[model samples]
Structure formats: structure tokens, C-alpha cells
Target: MSDTSPFDPVGHESLADAVVEQIETMIVDGILKEGHKLPSERDLAEAMGVSRPKLREALQILESRDLVTVRHGEGSFIAPLSGRAMSPALLALYARHGRAFYDYLEYRREQECFAARTAALRATQSDKDRLRDIIDEMQKAWEEDDAEASQEADLRLHVAVVDASQNTTLIHMMASVYDLTRQGVFYNRRFLRTMDGTGEKLLQQHKDIVATILAGDPDAAEQAARAHLDFVEESFRLGEEQKARETRAAKRRKLSGQASR
Candidate 1:
């Protein structure tokens, strides 16, 4: 009887499977972020050390899995995974309700605290450098009194911390959350920026978070994240209250004038 094993040695199919895994891992790690276009098939195959046929097979599989979108002539691109994670209906609901703002903050507080703690443990040297650069950007924005730039940097800092956590799930989920924040679906980012002394305080809070993470102090990083969120919640409350009072005062003045007329 022949002594050959029943299983075949790993072959073209296996090579294709490996290519799929490599691309998937890159996507999950955010190395190939959403909507990033893939290189030409020949270039990619050469870079990946695989034959063009195997790369094509892997690309086909990824396209079917909704992880990639292929254009007939333009080449393949990473699908917008983060955007798909949150439904339009849910986004609209959050936008329609004031209560959702605080709820979002509460959710973010927990998420950010966990992210900061994990980042402290997992952050690479490159991650630390990115955080430092973002802090510097925030400082520049603050000095220039540029609320929009400051707000953008604020979100970028939080996103960078989450990225440093090296947790794929958290990174994707928070991407959607931050997208909502950018769209002002929960609360106006400007409100937090416009409060008295808030820009300075926020810049410092971000710096402290980065410092703790860089120091590899998980406890301090978590606490700093929580404290920062607490301040943001309080600032939002105060801003809302002040707006309500102003609206009421305006209504009263309008009524008084009409009655006098």
C-alpha cells in the first residue's frame, strides 16, 4: 500500500488564503484605513511576495466579504467599515434628542477610560510620538484661538489614544463615535471650545493623558481620561443651561414689548 498521506501539501489555495489573512490583518490593525485605495495588482502581488493569480483570488474573497470594494478600472479600495458600523437611523435619533448627548458622553467616558488604560500598556514608540504631535497641534490651535482646529485636534487626540490601545474592536467602534461627534450629532464641539478658559484646560487635560500614557501608567491614564470627560460633561451642562436661560429671557422680553404695544 502506498504510504502517501491523505492530505495534500499546502498549494495555490493556501497561498491565496495567506494573502487574504495578510490583507485582513492590515485592515484590522488600521494600517490600511477605510477608503484607502489598494495598489495596482501587479505592484501589490510583488510587494506581498505572491503571484498575481493568488493576489487576485485573495482580492476577490475580500471583495465578497465586503471588506473591499473593487472598481472595474480604478482598482480596489478598503470599504468604509466604520461608517457602516453605525446606522443612519441611529445617527438621526441621536441627533434629534438632547438626552442623547449626555448618554453619548457617558458611553465615551467608559470607552475612553478603557482605551487610555490599554494604551498605557500597549502603545508603541510611534504611538507616543503621534500623541505628542497632536498635543503640540492642540497647543498651537489654542494659542491662535482657532476653535475649529482645536476641536479637530481634540478628536484626533482621543482617536490616537484609542489607536494606541491596539484593540481592533475599540478602534473601529470609536471611529464611528467620533464621526458622529464631528458631525455634531450629539453636541456641538464648539460649545466645549467656547467656554471660558476651556481651550486651555482642554489642552492641558489632553497633555496629561498623553503624559500618563507615555509613562506607561495605566491607572493615571484611566483617571485622567475620566476627569477630562467629567469636565466636558459639566461644560456641556452649563452651556445648555445658559442657552435655555437666554431663550427664556428673550421670550419674556418679546411678550413684554407686545403687551406694551
Candidate 2:
């Protein structure tokens, strides 16, 4: 029952309460993610250095709180906790509304900039390694001209940055936000990619962000994140305008053809 273990030895007199608190903390910290299965009763009790009776009591408490789901044949598992953050009906509304798209970008700018700044200051070595690996994937995708892969890597990099921030709230929130983007709530996948030179520019912006964070410059990291979002916002607006112009041109062409007929 080392301190570093997710389930440490219970020191409190109320063993059941202590076990419950420890498990709850792990869930809140994102260490034990949604749907992760708990160990068997015997194994869990041994790991936590608590009696099986006390462990069972804690499990009952967690189930009552709706934090854990215990199946008859299967072991206990963390409940689905992300449903509140990712409501399908709300996401549908956001996808249908044009205004929600830009509003989401604005929200992301603030949250992502803060994440980048905090990651710059607090990221562990492992976090830095993961970020660098994502950058490598992005670079490879760009070189190979794989637009879809590049976009996926871009989303992953942003999520990784938030993870490095070590803030549980931001980690969960940004994940949901990006999930919406993946579902096309903000814009179509081809909106930015269809434009000339946009891919190259995006790659460069991503590079700058990673560079700043790797340098451990909090201010520079925040600035880089802001700059990247600003570019994306401008690009989206331009794309929308281009689509409008194309639509108008198509209508004019159809009218001319009809008149000739």
C-alpha cells in the first residue's frame, strides 16, 4: 500500500469512509477514468490493506453515490461520467446553429491559452514526451499530405496540452469541446483544408505552439496558443465568405442559363 498507489492504505479509524474517499478522489482526478473496472473484492482489499468487509462497505457507498456500477457477474466499474458534458441534444443544436460555432472557438481560445501556459510551467517529462510524439505525428501527416490524419493529430495535440496542464476540469472540458468539433458541430472537416495554403500555415502554427511549450516559456506558450486560435478563427470566416460567394455565383449562372432557354 504505497502512497503512490491509487489505493493507498487506510489510516483513518472509519476504514470504509477512508476507502470511499480515496476512490472518489481518484475518480475526480481522472486517474480512474470512466468505465474503468475495479479490481475483484479480494484483490482490492489486499491492495488497499483493508479488510474485505470494509472494502465491501465502501463499494456499497460508492454505488449509492452513483459513482460506481456493480454488476452481478462482472466486477464494479466507474460509472459513465461524461454524459453531462456531452449531451447529444445540446450538441445537435450547436451543430445546427452557425453562431455556436464561433462562440465555441472563442471559448476554446481562452481555455486553450490557459492550458498552454500552465503546461509550459508544470508539465512533467512524460507529458513533454507525449506532446513531442504528437508533434512528430503532425509533422509526418503534413509531409505526407494526409489532411485527415493531420487534423486528427491537431486535435490530439490540443488535448495533450490540456492533459499536461494537470487540471482535471480543463482536461474533461476540453476533451468534450474537441469531441464536438470532431462531430462537425463547429465546422465541416473540409472548411479549412479546402483553402489554399491553409494547411501549411496551420502546421507552422502548431509547430510554434509546441516550440514555446517545449521551451518552458509560459508567456510565449500562451501567446502562441492565442495566435493559433486567431488564425483558425480568421480562416473559418474566410471560408464561410467564400462559400457564400460560390453560392451566389451558382445562382447567377442558373438564372443566365434559364433566361437563354
Candidate 3:
């Protein structure tokens, strides 16, 4: 996406507002993508046929809305629209409540299943290649015991699957919760993998998902994704159960020590 073509001069009564709307329309339409740099003040003003003062007002409006970020000396650039709005709030929820994390997984399960099915049906050759590359990276990271890298690769693979879905709305929706997903799923992956045989099983599951998608088997892709997430959810439950048991044992030990004293 790029800056939109020039429009007629802002001769309307609400000139600044009209200019703001024009720029907003360009951004909302994806003509100016996240992180894309805007034209210089003079260039933009000339292009839009608006006075420099009017362009500044429009820029200020965009900045206020966080659609643009202005740096000292440097020009304005498109701001990241997804995380700015939701990340902090979602992070607070995850931090405050354990169950919020599981709720996220439930949401992810539904979204990923749909993404996997759609990807199987629509993935381009390039998307398949990227998935294969990420899988290879996962394999290398796992073999080298690079847990962080492996988790990153795992997340990337899932994100790539969603990207292959070719659904813009779906993409945006997933992107909105991506930070929560990263924190909940990727951050906890190491602990889950520590369970005996769990890491190997997960690796096989990832392979199955990619293979099914490559084979253009939407049903199998969806099943593979569901099966993988089912394993993850069960692991989460078992981990919580173990923690409860450990807490109970600690309490009992404390009580025994107190009685002996």
C-alpha cells in the first residue's frame, strides 16, 4: 500500500476536517500500511492541494488517533494499528487471572481450526514454502535445545497458516490478539514440552498439520490443528492439577512439622 493519488484541492468549508478524512480513508483502505512513511510536508501538501497549515492540522488529527507517529526531525510514519489498542488491556487480563489464559486458548482453537482449513484450501506455493521453512527452523531449534527459538518458530508457523487463509478480516482479528497468543502459548510452550514425550508429540503434530495442508486436505488440516490444541489444553489442565497436589503436600508437611514441634 502507498500514499493515495492526489485529490482536488480542499476548497470545502471544513478544509482541515476534509483533509483529515481523506488521509484517514487512505489509511483505512490500506493504501498507507503500518510503518509506511508519509510524504514530506511540502510534497504532501502539494499533492493533496491543501495548504501546509491545513496538512499540519490533518497530521495532528491522525497523530491524536495514533494512525501516525511523528518523530523529531524524522517524518511521520504509519503507526501499528493492532497492538496499540488492545495489547496492554489483554496483558493486564492475562496477568490478573490464570483462567484468562485458557480462555485465550479456547478462542485460538476456534480461530486456528478455521485458519488451518482455509489455508489447506487456499495456501499459495509461497505460503507452503514459508511453512516448510519455519518447520525446519523448529526442527533445528528443538534438536539444539533452543527452546526460545523453537517457540518463536512454532508461533511463526501458526501465524503463517493464518496468513495463508486469504481472509483480510480473519487476519486482522487474529492479529489483534496476537500478543496474547504469544504470551500465553509461546511463553508456556517450554513448560508444556518438558512433560515426557510431549515435545516429540508436538513436533509430530506440527508436521502433520503442514503435510495435510500441503496435500490440500482441508478436513485433515482442521483435524490436525484440533488434535494438537487438544493436547496442549490437556497438558495445561494436568499441569494445574500437579500444582494443586504439590500445594496440598506442602501444607501437610507444614502441619506435621508443627505437631512435632
Candidate 4:
């Protein structure tokens, strides 16, 4: 019988992730070095026994993660690691989706905390105003009792803070950083069952963050961001524990049913 475990290439993960893992291993094992040119697209596809499109997709993933540098005319080269540029997207990739939900959230919170600290050091007056506008939007959404609106405003608020450092590259790099955090924290925040005054509480905290930014102190902004992340981390922790317990119960029930049969 053929093996059908999720660890198989055609199972749990995308083909792209599987191919990326294979290439990453070669690099890590010293088979590929910095500035080393990888095989031509066709050659790589032949070697991996995958289609050209699948191989390209895997290379794109590697490019995004800074593991490989694709030069338009010069082909793909092993990327340098002189300066590590971390983001929530990288964290999400590391987390491996729902199976690693809580683990991913923890990593994202750390990155957000670091960005917040840097924002305090570099935010400008315009950045401060942008933060205020986001908070005001949240407050209005809360008064209207609109969860979607409130959550969206909450998302923009966090992203805007990271964008405030005026580093266009950083801004672009973190474009999708909050995606995992959104699924982790906002699901609970938006749910009526798990949420109690979460929208209002977040509004209040956002207001405080705006005030800190307006005061032109990065230290205060950093503290406010940390405080907010703390609440978010706690929320995910409880959710994680609940999920773990349920998973074990499901497994036991499955075993019991099999034994009875």
C-alpha cells in the first residue's frame, strides 16, 4: 500500500512549501553557499521531478523569505544573511498554520513589540496624526457597535503604527505581518461567545497609544504597544489550552470507537 500520511508532498502542505524545504536543506547542509548560482529553472524542475511552474513557485517563496536572490538577467543566487529582516509573514511561515496557531501568535507578538519600540524612536508628527485617526475610527465603530468595522479599524491601527517609522522597505516587508495575528486574536475579539467588551477595551487602549505617539515619545509608544500585546497574548494562551484539551478528547474518542468495533 502507498503511504498517505500528511508528511507526504501531496498532503497537508502546499507543493511549494515542500519544494522550498528541499532546497533549504541543501543550502543549510553547505551544498549551496552565498552567491552560488542555482540550477536553471528547467534543470531544477527536472532534478526535483516537478513541473516548471511548481518549481518557480517554490523559488518565489524562497525569494520572499530572503533565502534566495533572483536576479532578472543573472539568474538566482544564494541570498546573504548579513542583516536579518524579520516580519509577521516570516513568523506565519514558521508557525505552519492552525496546527501552530498559538506558537505563531507568540512569535508575531514579539515582532510587533519590536516594531512598536522602533516606531517610538522614529515616528513623526504625521505618523502621530495617522495613529489618532485610526483610534478615532475605532471609537466611532465601537459606538456604532459594528464588530467588522471595529476589527478592521483595529487592524489598520496596528499596521499604521508599524508603518510610522517611515522606512518604506519595512512598511512593504510587513505588509502581511498581521495576518496570523488577526486570525489568532481577532477571531476571539470578534466572536460574541469569547468576547466581552473587547472592542471597547481596545478602543480605550488605542486612544492611549495615540496620546503617547502625539506626545512624541517612542518609549511611551513602545510601552503602550507592549501592554496591548500582553492582553492579546493572554487571550491566545487560553484559546490554545482549550484547543489542546479538545484535541486530546477527540483522539481518545476515536480510539474508543475503534476498540469497540
Top-TM-score structure, candidate number:
1
Measured on C-alpha atoms, candidate 1 has an lDDT of 0.86
For model 2 the local lDDT of residue 246 reads 100
Candidate 2, residue 224: lDDT = 96
Per-residue CA lDDT of model 1 for 203-246, tens digit only, reads: 88899999999999999999999999999899988988999999
lDDT of 2 at 40: 89
Prediction-by-prediction clash tally = 0, 0, 0, 1
Count of backbone collisions in candidate 3: 0
The C-alpha TM-scores of every prediction are 0.86, 0.80, 0.72, 0.52
Candidate 3 residues lying further than 4 Å off, grouped into runs, are 1-77, 83-90, 184-187, 196-198
Instruction: Candidate 4: give its CA RMSD in angstroms.
Output: 16.5
lDDT of 3 by residue, 64-152 (tens): 99888988699989888765424576567667777866777788899999999999999999889999999999899888888889888
Cα distance off (Å), candidate 4, residue 7: 51
Task: State the lDDT of candidate 4 residue by residue for 1-261, as single tens digits.
Answer: 124211223323567777898778766533454567887877666555677788789889999999999999888998864333345575556555554555545665666666677777777776778887888888888888887788788878878877766555455445544554455523445642254444666677778766776776767777787787677667666777888999999999999999999
> Which residue pairs collide in model 4, if any?
120-218
TM-score of 1: 0.86
Give the alpha carbon lDDT tens digit for every residue of 75-94 in model 2.
99998776544478877887
lDDT of 3 at 257: 98
Q: List the residue pairs that clash in candidate 3.
A: none
- Estimate the lDDT of model 2: 0.85
Query: Looking at candidate 4, what is the lDDT of residue 118?
Result: 75
CA displacement after TM-score superposition, residue 198 of candidate 3 (Å): 6.5
